[model samples]
Target: MWRDEAATWQVAQRSTAEIWHLLANVDVVHGLYYLLMHVLFTCFGPGTTTLRLPSVLATAVAAACVAVIGRRVAGSWAGLAAGLAFGLLPAVQFHLQEGRSYALVAAGAAISTLFLTTVLQRPARTRHWAAYSTTVLLTGLLHWLSLMILAAHLATLLWTRAGRAVLARWAAAAGCAVAGVLPLIVFSRGQSVQVAWIPPLTWHMLIGPAVLLAIGGTCALPDRPRAGRLSAATVGLPLLAVPQLGLIALSLLQPVFLDRYVLYSMLGLALLIGAAVGAAVRAARPRFPTASRWILPVTLAVAMSALLPQSLATRSPASRVDDVLAIASDIRHLKRPGNAVLFVPPLRRDVKSLTPDAFAGLRDIALAVPPEKSGTLRGVETAPDRIRAALLAEQRVLLVTDASPGARPARGARDRMKTAVLHRYFVPVADEQTRGRRVIVYERRSTPR
Candidate 1:
């Protein structure tokens, strides 16, 4: 998790103007988050705690908002149960420590939905609608994909048949949000290459939404006629279904179905589960008053026990696809002053950017310009001929590459040359592999003849 956190930290390390320039061309979706982290880094200095604190706090606020939604739609017991269930969610816990926009996006979704509920319930307050629109706009600024939550809100409004007046207000608010996000959408489109790695919809993607619906349906079954069930289904069902399904559907044309993108949807599941548990407890009270009193406590205890392993695993380095801190430590131990480093694809140079301090003693032999100077994350690389010459000239070269199985098979002319140079002039001296990356040291076998 913190492996990707380095990208956030790298953006934070730049000057505000530099960050703004970088965002104009790429990463516009996370522009607002980087700005917020810039302020945090300025005040607290860039440490793991400072980097991740906002996400933790945002998660706490989102959990509180879920409780409020549960109370409004169901009851006090439902609210408590919903909030507790939210905190125990594996997805929620995973993003809490991440220094990214996902947690903030989830928080924005919760708060904006809370406001949407108020506007629907009252249907007269212009201010409520304004607040809702503003929150939606802000959420989109944090991460444009969060606007998907508005589709769920639209579905909920339509399902409830919340009078023409309420529907009109929601439409107006949603239009304003769309307008607010238009510029970012345009800029992000220019950077569409970022999401190219998203695979097409799979059985797992289909199963995720189906499982959520099953849980919600089970909850709704127990109290079909109750206002609580109706409200929960109206709001929760779409929130759990639409974002994922919409993304999956769109993935056929363009891939974007990532679980973290819709992490907020879990709030809907929690609300339904909480309402069902509360209903079950009430239904059992008359038959077994003593056991009914124990229901909430026992349920929470059991839930926590089930979630304990996942929560603990979330803190381990293995939980992340890569661990920048661990990689940095390895580089520190293995590298000597003036050692030359080569990122196989050149883009892999980002690994050094993540742990700049550890790489201070080393030199990027193929770098033609620094990242800040080039206005790119990985920086510009030297020409292919220059890279080959540089590699041959070095006594020891550190090769960094993706940890994937196919990484050794050269995929492009540049990579082929890199492999050829390494094999023709050098011998492997040492190697280390991590979850996300591989590091190998090659020593000159003989003088370049």
Candidate 2:
């Protein structure tokens, strides 16, 4: 497991009351997902399969929704193409097995879009609007960033030039959904510091969206869809463009432009690609009717072939930034009884929390409280002077830190103090670095007073 997955594993292992308390102080946005995982772990016992099964199922549902929407707007061939394409997208594949809520959010977005497509084709019944509103509300609860889909849907309505009844009903349904999630939005604002690590937007960030829009726009061109039509261009284009552009605009004020936040947008891209395939099939039927049937399968086969390597890579441990399990194994092998342990940035304590057995018989010299009791992901730590004093007393210490040699220097007094004391008083006895983490054994200098 990587750091984020390790976080889910450890947090979900906490008791219900402990999770509730943790949410009160941090990670409120993931409260529902963590609770859901907690239940799964309770029933099935915590393991990789239990941790990631929901995401796999959710991704399947999202792909199915894409296929259904594509069939409604384009044709059966389009539906098959879109569904297959959705699963093949690099972004979709990356989160397909993640233990995060984003995949569920993507599934919810696709369901909401499917409902909207149905309502647009038929008269907007009260039940349809209710289902739409409920889906939106649930998706927003999963992750408020998904509420960006609401803007994309509004653009769809405008592009289609829906009657006042449709527009008014959409407004009412969207209003209910927004109102339901508004409290979560209000509460999660207090934890905004969780996103402080996101870097400021730059010109290069635009390249990905621009490339996606170009491809979606190209696929849309073949449709010749009118403004007031319920076609791929009218629905798919806005779904793909609005959320990405909206995120860029929002990043002007805050740096929240992670593409996974808008992973649902890939559904739109898939729909457009399917429509383009449908158009090609129609045009080719007149000339080579028998061979035209082979078009979609042939296209899918080529795509699968092209993406096979990347897909395999995503399934590997190297895909993530670091592997917490590997780091824990090293700690387990290198540690001795009563050895003092220190995590340079402290957040590296996740390794211990996720696999405590690996850290058995070791003392966390800097921790003042455990994570569950402290209601923090990383437990509270002692002051710099106390940590320095503790380090001075220990003959041997184990340091688990990031592997990057050029990582940012310690900024806080506590972290700086740890670094200074280690350099001045300790000598490296043994060191092993793997999987983006380093485990080092250090001993006090021989001539030290």
Candidate 3:
């Protein structure tokens, strides 16, 4: 999305500054993120791999950062576990496969939070302060949502340490942050859309992050809590699990809630919980055997890891690069000017249509509605009247219906395109198949004599 949309916007505007001009008012703070991504993609050359390269490298670098920070917080063993766990996380794995900035957001958020914590705990550390400021500013520029993570970091910093130190550092950082981000702050005032939600913390949601954290955090947490079983379970499981639960609930209603965005929050909770459990276990000999403490955490981790889906439902092939290339080639060959492309009933959210996904590849092919916007355009056209109103412009109208043959709207949409109401407007030319998925193509029929 970042690649295709930014590529189109930048091409239309012709310069980085112009790209900023178009988006700054529209996306507000998020415009800066697209602006920066625009600069990099231009330099790297326009393609998904080129566009998303920075995020891949950033994820690798973030894993390394985790290890370094973990060692500082706990010990070498804990650092290794934390780094490895983050790299292998199911959420991280999913985001890494996409050509988006979320992975970089995870990296920047994690590194910045580490700096904020370090500076708060050891107030006199100037180096950590400088580093914290840089990452926080960069993260804000990278994504507006990064601000939320920064808010959580600042809250934790103020709450964790006592009066003068916490107040002083937070004030200084907040001032710097605001001054640097004045541009986005001014722009994001009116255009944004929001979805409200009631938080859901269910059993399935808790299982994964909780188990991973307990396993990874064990190395760092103190030994006394570590000795017994109950201490480990309580600290290790719920601490990390809770935030993931919050995220999962948010995601269902608003699909915008991606897994990687709150990964830093998960790690923070995990470390605290694991340390508590380890400490309690060491305090006394428990009813269960000494091995049971280790045994249970290990068992849960293995089971949970197995359950998380490694391959998400892709709109195309599971291999994102191959899928994009395949679609792009198809667009180059099949799409031509004067060929009217229609997006009827927009593609279903659950079902990924090849048309929108392959739009960027079509070069100059005029479309019914641009691919990036197919969803919104479809949503806006409610009844048959609205769909009919939108259809009058194109000589050829292509209907994008869900694959379910039994759905009422899908049948209606197909029927409408068949020319029951507008007899002279369209004729079916071809039916394109994408990996067993279907996209029907149509052209305008001649007007009656």
Which candidate wins on TM-score? 2
Candidate 1 vs candidate 2, lDDT winner: 2
Arrange candidates, best TM-score first: 2, 1, 3
Model 3 over residues 1-449: C-alpha lDDT tens digits? 42233333333323555554446334444455565666766677656666556667877877776666555545454455556555555566656555556777777867775665465446456666667777777876766555565455544543344467656766677668656866665556454442222234456655665675555456434533332222222222332444455566556655445445565554554344334433444443365556635643573477456744453443225323222133334444555654444443343311223234545332222234432343221223245555455456556544333233423443455446534534456566755544323445556567631
Candidate 1 residue 298 C-alpha distance from true site, Å: 0.7
Models 1 onward score TM values of 0.94, 0.98, 0.63
Q: Per-residue lDDT tens digits of candidate 2, residues 96-115?
A: 89888889999999999999
Per-model C-alpha RMSD:
2.3, 1.2, 7.9
Candidate 2 residue runs with Cα over 4 Å from true position: none
lDDT for model 1 comes to 0.82
Mark the regions of model 1 whose C-alpha exceeds 4 Å error after superposition: 225-230, 404-412, 447-449
- Highest-lDDT candidate: 2
lDDT of each: 0.82, 0.91, 0.50
lDDT of 1 by residue, 1-449 (tens): 34468788788989998898778767878899999999999999988889899999999998999888878877777788888888888889999888998999999999998997777666468888888999999999998888889899988877777778777888999999989999988889889887886787777678877887788778866546333223766777778777877777778888888888889888888888878877878788899988987888999999989888988998888788766555666677778888898887666677787667878878888889888777677778877798898887888888888777635466567778888899889998888887677888889987542
Q: Which 10-residue window of candidate 1 scores lowest in summed lDDT? A: 221-230
**C-alpha lDDT of residue 10 in model 2:** 84
**350 in model 2: Cα distance from truth in Å?**
0.8
